[model samples]
Target: MGKPVLIIISGHPATGKTTFGKMISEELKIPLVSPDGIKEILWDNIGWKHDFTEWSNVGKVSFELMYYFIETCLAQGKSLVAEAHFHPEINNARLNALKDKYGCKLLQVHCKADKSVIEERFRQRMASDNFHPGHRHGIVEVYGEEKFYDKLGKGEKLLNIDGEVYEVDTTNAENIDSNKVLEFIKSNL
Candidate 1:
C-alpha cells in the first residue's frame, strides 16, 4: 500500500477550483470534500437566511464538517481531495497538523487566473439560477463588489505549509489538462 495522499485544491473564489478538484478526485478515485458542498446540504436541511451573519455562521459549520470528514478519512488510511477557498491564518495550522499526524503526503494545487477574469466568472456564477442563494446573498448582496474583489485579490497565494505545490493557470479553464495534473500527483505520491 502507498501513503495516503491529501490533495488540497485551493484558490480565490471562481478560479475553477471545484471543477478541477472534481477531475482530480475522479481520476484518483478519491473522495472530494468541499465546504460549499456541505454548506449546500446544510442549507437544504437546516435552512439559510439572506443575512450576512447567518451565511457566515453556516459557512463556519460547513468548514467544521469538512474537517471532520477529512480527519475521519485520514484516520481510516484513505486518501481524499479537499477543495476550498482556504485562508492561511484560519486553515494552515489545522491542515499541517493533520498531515503530520497521519503521515499523509500533502499536495496543494493552487489555481490562478487574472483578476478581471475571476471577477467576471464570479459575477456570472452569482447571477446563475443554479448557484446557491446563500452564496449570492452573502457574497454579492452583503459584501458588495468592492469588498468581495478585495478579499479575492488578497487570497491569490498558497497556504503556508510544507508540501509539494502545483500551480495551475485557470484563466482559461478549458486549457487545463487533467491528465497532466494526474501525472504530477502520481509522481509525487
Candidate 2:
C-alpha cells in the first residue's frame, strides 16, 4: 500500500542479528532474507559433511538466492528484512541500485556484543552439532580465536543508506529488545 522499506539486520556473528530479524519480520509482517537460513536449506539438501571448506559454495549459492529475493521483493513493492553479517568487504551497490530504482527506504539495524561474549557464544556455536552448518564452521575454528575476535572487534561500519539506523547491544542478555526494533521499523513505515 505504501513504499516498501528494506530493513537490513546486520552485524558480526553471534550478535543476535537473526533473533532481531525474526522479531522485526513478525512485527512488520515482512519476509526475512537470511543467507544463514539458505545455507541450512543447502545443508538439508546436500548434507553437512563437517568439512572445513563447506561454507564456500554454500555461501555463494545462498547469497545468489538472497539477492534474487531482494530484487523480487523490491520489484513487487513488498517490504522485507534481510539478515547478514554485512562485513566491510561486502559491497552495497546492488542494494543501492535497487533502492534508487524502487524508491524504498533502507533501514539498518546494527547488532553488537562485547568481544569476550561474542567469543564464548561463537565457540559454543562451533562446538554445537545442532547449529547451522554455515554458522558453525570457519568463523571460530578456521580463523582461530584471535582472528575471530579481531574480526568481530573491528566489525563492519554501516553503509550510507537513505534511512534511519538502530543499534542493539546483546552481549549479556539472551533476549534482544525487539520492541525497540519494531518501533524503529514502524516509525519508518
Candidate 3:
C-alpha cells in the first residue's frame, strides 16, 4: 500500500474544518481525526481549557500527541485526515520534525468558509459540544469571530517566516475549484 496522506485541516472549530475534513476524508477514503473529537473523547482527562501555559506550549504538546496518533495510523499504511485548529505557531515545528522522521507528507488545509457559514457552524458545534450547566465556570462555547479574524491577521505575520508553509483562504471555498487552495499546497510540496 502507498504511504497515507497526512492532511491537517487547520481553522477555528466552527470554520468548516470538520465538514471539509470529512468531505476530503470521504473523497480520499481515509480515516478522519478531529482534535475536537479527540478532545471530546478524552474531555474529562484533557479538560476544556488548557490555560496552563502559553498558546504555543499547549499547542506544541497537543501537536506532539496528535503527531504520534496520526503517524501510527500512517505507519500502518492507513490514510488519515486530521481536523483541528492545529495552531501553526505551536504545531508547525513538530510537524516539520514528523515530516523528517517518517517521510510523512504535511498538507495544512486552511478551512475558510464564509463568516455566516462559520457562525452557523460554531453555533451548532457549541450546542453539541457537551455543554453542561454549573459544571465548568465561565465555559461559554461562543466564538469571538471578530477577535478570531484579528488574531488570524496577527498570526499571518509568522507565515512569511516559513516560505514552505502553504496558505489558503477557503472563504467562499466551496462548490468550485478550490484550486487556489490546491495550488497553495502543490507549490509548497
Candidate 4:
C-alpha cells in the first residue's frame, strides 16, 4: 500500500553487490533487477567475451533487455533491487534517463571491502565463477578497492543518484556489521 521504490545496487564486480542486494530485497520485500544474472541467462544465446569485439550487437542486446526488464518491473508498481557496477557512464546515462521517463526512485548502494579482502574473496569466488561460461578473470577482481579507487580517480561517476546512497566499507571497524547498510537504507526510504 506504499509507493514503489527503485533500489539500485552498484559497485565493481565481486564486491558482493548482488548478494547484498538480494538480502536487502528480501528484507524489504522488494523485487530484484539483476543485470549480471541476465548476462548469465543470455550467455549461450549470444557471443561470449572472446567474441565481444566481433559482435557489438551482443552488448546492445544485453542492455536492451536490461532496459526492458527494469521498465517492466517499475510498471508493475514494485520496488526493485538492482545490482551492477554502474561505474560505466553509459549505464549511468541509461538509468538517469529511465528514472526521468518512468518516475522511478533510485537507491544506490556502494558496497566496499578492503582491497586484499576483495581479492581473496575474488579468488574464492573465481574458483566457481571463473568456470561459468560468461565469466573470466578480470583485473578489477584481482585488484579490488584499489581498482575501484583508481576508477573513481579516472572519473567514474560515484553518483548519489536520486540523492540516495548507502556507502559501506567493511574495512572500517564501524561497518563491520551490515547494520550500517540497513540503517542507511531505512533512513533513505
What do the candidate models score in CA lDDT, each in turn? 0.85, 0.78, 0.56, 0.64
Error of 3 at 83 (Å): 1.4
lDDT of 3 by residue, 1-189 (tens): 244457777765455567667876776677887655554444456454544343234344555567678889867767577877755676667667656666666666765555566666545644674543212221333323455434432333121122244445445644546555555544544
- By summed lDDT, the worst window of 10 consecutive residues in model 2 runs over 134-143
Off by over 4 Å in 1: none
Ranking by TM-score: 1, 2, 4, 3
- List, residue by residue over 34-147, the lDDT tens digit for candidate 4: 756776667666545544343345446656776787788878776677776665556767777767877777778877666666566656665674545455422233334355
TM-score to native of every candidate shown: 0.93, 0.85, 0.62, 0.75
- Output the better candidate (1/2) by lDDT: 1
Query: Candidates 3 and 4: which is better by lDDT?
Result: 4
Compute the lDDT for candidate 1: 0.85
Model 2 CA lDDT for position 153: 47
lDDT, residue 86, candidate 4: 68
Best by TM-score: 1
Residue 35, candidate 3: how far off, in angstroms? 1.3
Question: Candidate 1, residue 94: CA error in Å?
Answer: 1.2
| Residue pairs in candidate 4 whose N, alpha carbon or C atoms collide under 3 angstroms | none
What is candidate 1's TM-score against the reference? 0.93
User: Considering every candidate listed, which one attains the maximal lDDT?
Assistant: 1
RMSD versus native structure for model 3: 5.6
Q: Which stretches of candidate 4 lie above 4 Å from their native place?
A: 44-50, 54-60, 129-131, 137-157, 171-175
Q: Between candidates 2 and 3, which one is better according to lDDT?
A: 2
Q: Give model 2's TM-score versus the native structure.
A: 0.85
